[model samples]
Target: MHDMQKELSTDELMGRFLNQLKDEDQLTEKQKRIMEAAVKLFSEKGFHAASTSEIAKEAGVAEGTIFRHFKTKKDILISLVAPIMLRFASPLLLKDVRKLMGSDLPLDDLLKQLYQNRLQIIEKNWSQIRLIIQEMQFHEELRGAVVENLFGVGRKLAEAFVSSKIQSGEIRNFPPLTVTRALVSMMVGYVFFKFVIFPDEGMNLDDEQEIEIMVDIILNGIRNKE
Candidate 1:
């Protein structure tokens, strides 16, 4: 087949697998509506809580229409997961992050910029993030995808960053992998604390202030003084 035809076919397959595709990708109108509705309902009510009838109602389609496009509600959930993961895996964001990693900035400064960029992304996709976290335990496939797409892709870069800091005596001489995990844990813990445990409106510190404090705490533990 021609390259154009192959590309079109792949786009069609991608459309079937994800609700939020690029503006130019083509999903049939009903499929588009179904996907959009499913995503909203899933994000709001969750996979177990939201029903197919409700999705159909939200999409203004017959309940059977959803079945016509998908084998099960879990199928829709699976489809939604790909797009949510894609937001983080996007080429532009990866390029920007790669640039940051390669820059001459100090470790703390680099981390602050990285955190800010990631926080912006997390905030924008909080709904989907919540959905994935809530459901990942029950869905092995989803968990695997998250591990592979999210963590697997970034592991080498993280290790390299940690190693560089260690060699320069900027951070403690822990194993590169250990340092990377610790840093990630710190950020992840902070995100949960800020967003889940005690959401910002209740917090005393503003976002920038919170970021500063978190960075300070991280540096205090990891900075090498010897």
Candidate 2:
């Protein structure tokens, strides 16, 4: 087949797949309306307490539309993950980190910028984050995809950064992977605890303060004392 023909074929396949997903019995216009309503209802009421009829009414769709799109109402709840991940992953992957850490930016400034960026991302996606945490116990595949797509990229990027810093003699001589995991664990744990575990009294620390504390703790252990 000609290259152009192959490309056209691939495009057609993708279009068909997308259309199928959109037009799924449970995902038609009415179903989408219901799903949107369900998401809001679920967020406010919790998934277990939210009902299909309530979602349908809120969406201005019949209760049957909800069932048509998703065999069970729980499926609508699960579907939110895909859209959330799709919206968030691009920025996380493609944002210009190098520009943020340019030569003019001091280490403290760079760290502060990075932390604030991460914090903003987490805050924006807090709903999806909550959904994943709540459902992971029942859905191993969802948990795996979340780890693979989200944390996996983070770990790779962090490992590369740590390796470069160590090579430049700006950081300590710990194993790159180990240091990356430790740093990520520290940052992720702080975010998870502050936003998810204790949102009522979220960490009120300013970006600079949080970055300073993290940098001080990490640098103290990693910097060559010589």
Give lDDT: candidate 2, residue 85.
Answer: 49
> Compared with the true structure, what per-residue lDDT tens digits does model 2 show for residues 7-98?
12323422332333332355557666776687678777776667777888899978776666666664565466665544445444436654
lDDT of 2: 0.64
Evaluate all candidate structures by whole-model CA lDDT and list the values in order: 0.75, 0.64
Query: Top lDDT: which candidate number?
Result: 1
- List TM-scores for all candidates, in order: 0.78, 0.69
Best by TM-score: 1
Return the lDDT, model 2, position 158.
Answer: 72
Q: For residues 43-119, what per-residue lDDT tens digits would candidate 1 score against the true structure? A: 78877778999999999999988888776787666566666677776565588888999899988888889888888
| lDDT value, residue 165 of candidate 2 | 78
